[model samples]
Every structure is written in structure tokens, then in C-alpha cells.
Target: MAAAQNTPGQHRGMDWCGFAGFRASKAPMQAYAAELGATMQLQVQMPRRQPAPADIVEEYTYTRHFVAIDDPVRLLEILPGLPADKNHTYEIILKDKPCKLCVDFDGTDGLPACFASKQDFTSRVQDVLTDIFLTEFGVQLPAESFVWVFTDYPVKFRAHLVEHHIMPDGRILCLPQHNPTHATRRRQALLQQAGAGHA
Candidate 1:
């Protein structure tokens, strides 16, 4: 059987409220909680975790015509402390006229000791974030965006949608949210179209 998922308090007081509760004199988890809060505030533009798996299944149907954001570094940063062997991936796709970001982390090599430790995880995550910001957005090292982190087992991936920037003609600045498979299909289609028109 899989190792037990950490309890809400397993991280030692880092609960869902985004604050670490104090049991006594120790406040070890407080620093991490503050860092996490700041990270969420700067990176995740939207608040709250994505719909649960059960809720997603009950409410939505997976479709094509979506976009995919394949940023391995971003994935690493968002899920700080995951084992190196545990590879994580996030897919933002088009579903129901909105973009949804889905995250999953698997044992690429093999699962190491549950994250190694939170501090190490957080530092590594920050490094990943730095790289992602510089390379993708071509902005500074720590540019902020609308990304959120969820608390899923193995890892969590979160997203906030771009809702307000809609046009009267029904045009969307962001693409739809679908699975990575669909995104791959879309990419191939785009490449094929581009190739066909070559002189």
C-alpha cells in the first residue's frame, strides 16, 4: 500500500488556513508558512485549489481545442520539496471555455524519502521559480503571475483563470484548458499547417 498521506497537521501546524498554528513555544513551521503565503501571493494570481478530482469528473467533460503550458521548472517550483526522483508535470488546458491547470507528480526514477525535508524543498522550488520567470516571460528573475499551488498527494498543482479580460465579441486572451494529450495534438496540427504553407 502507498505510504500514508501527511495529515493536515503533519507538516507540524501548516494547515489549510495558510498559517501555522502554535502548540507551545516552538514556531518552526511559521517561517515556512510565511514564505509559502508570500509565494502564493506573488505567483498564483488566482486563489484556491482547483476542483477536486471527484468534482471535476462530475461537473466537466474533457475536450480538445485547449492549450498546454509545459514548464518543467515551473512545475518543480510550484511543488517544492518533492523528491528529485519524483518528476512533476502541470498541464493547463481548455475545458468548457476556460483554462484549467492540472498537476501530477510521479516517481520518475523512484520515490525517495517523502520530500527529504521541507526547507530543502522550499529552496529548490524557489530556484525553479527563478529560472522559469527569467526564461519564459522574459521578465526579471521573480516576475509574478496568476499561478496557484494545490495540496495534492505526491504533489499539488493550482491555477487561477483569466476571466475579466473578455471581449464583447467573445474573444479570450487565454486558451481553453484540456489534457496534455490534446495540447500535443494541437501543437502537431499547428506545425503541420505551418509546414504545408512553406515556399
Candidate 2:
């Protein structure tokens, strides 16, 4: 079940940037990365967070490409030297090319899974935050655990997350919000349909 820890004075009413927290787990990284070496390729895969009971997915996420620990003895040595509290991790930018990432938010209701760029690397953070929210609370939250919602509507052509689809986990997944003009037009069309149906 997902759990949350709130930070003080961080809430901005119903729709602004809010901070919802959850219980973090011990890092299973060292054991996970042990199958690495110069000759033997480490087939890396990480578990994706499930927002609902039925949606269990896995993403092949890695920060760095290759950890050049060819010697068996060296692998045992430096692993212990890494710091703790590494629940949140990043992929290595390898010498061959930048590491490709595939991220899923909540794993239940997701924005499409695609390769991310260096500029948009931070966006995957939403995936991490959503994972914690869903896994701990047993609820699929909006792509929000630590997110900055706009104070006003149509912030950079994107509207608010007020009315949206509620997932099985009680999370709201709103359609991509755009400019006020388009949203207003869509709302007008919906209202017209409602009126026609009543008549």
C-alpha cells in the first residue's frame, strides 16, 4: 500500500504545486547490478510501480551504460563504497551514446512509454513519485507526488487537473490540457450536447 508524508507549508490550495510523500524501501541496487562485467553483459531491468492490482509492468531503466569493472574482485570492493539512501536512482551516460530511458507513470494509467532526452530527464521524476504514491497508498495518483500545478488555468497552454478520469486506484488522469480558447470551446460543445440531450 502507498503511504504519504506531507511537508509543512507546501500546499497551495486545491490545484497548485503540492507535495505528497510515501514510504521508501531499501535500495536493491547492488544486488541488482551484480551481473555486470566486461565480457558478461548485465541485462538490466527495474520494476515499475503498480497503481492498481492488475497492472504489473517492468521498465528497463539504467542510469549509466557500462560500469567498467572487468575484474571480479573489483566488483566486490567498490560496491560497498557507494552511499546509502539511494532509493531514487539515475542511469549512466555511457561512452558509446546517452543512455536511453523508458518511463511509466503509476504503471496503471500512463503517459506513453518512450525514450527520454537529456533536457526532459527530470520529467521521469513524475514516474518515480507516482510509483511511491501508488505502491504505498494502493491508489493511483495523478502524475503528481511532487508536482507544480499552475496557480492559473492555461499555464503555457495547459489547463488545470480539476475534472478528469478517476482510475481504479482513485487517481485522476486528465487529458492533456491546452490553451483557454480550446478548452472553452470544448466545454461549450459538451454543454451544447448536454442541453440537446435534455431537450
Which one wins on TM-score?
1
Candidate 2 off by > 4 Å: 1-37, 40-66, 87-199
lDDT of 2 by residue, 1-199 (tens): 3332222231112111112211111122232335442432221112234342332111111111123345657545544543342222333323334222222112122221342432232344445435644686565656433333221111111112232236666745433333445545544443233231110
- lDDT by residue for model 1 (18-126), tens: 2211121123233433654432211111122444355333112211111112354543444554334333343434455455322232222222243354343334444
Model 2: how far is 90 from its true place, Å?
16
- Model 1, backbone clash pairs (residues 3+ apart or across chains), number: 11
Q: What's the TM-score of each model vs. the native?
A: 0.25, 0.17
Name the 10 consecutive residues with the lowest summed lDDT in model 2: 151-160
lDDT of 2: 0.31
Error of 1 at 66 (Å): 27
Reference-based lDDT, residue 10, model 2? 17
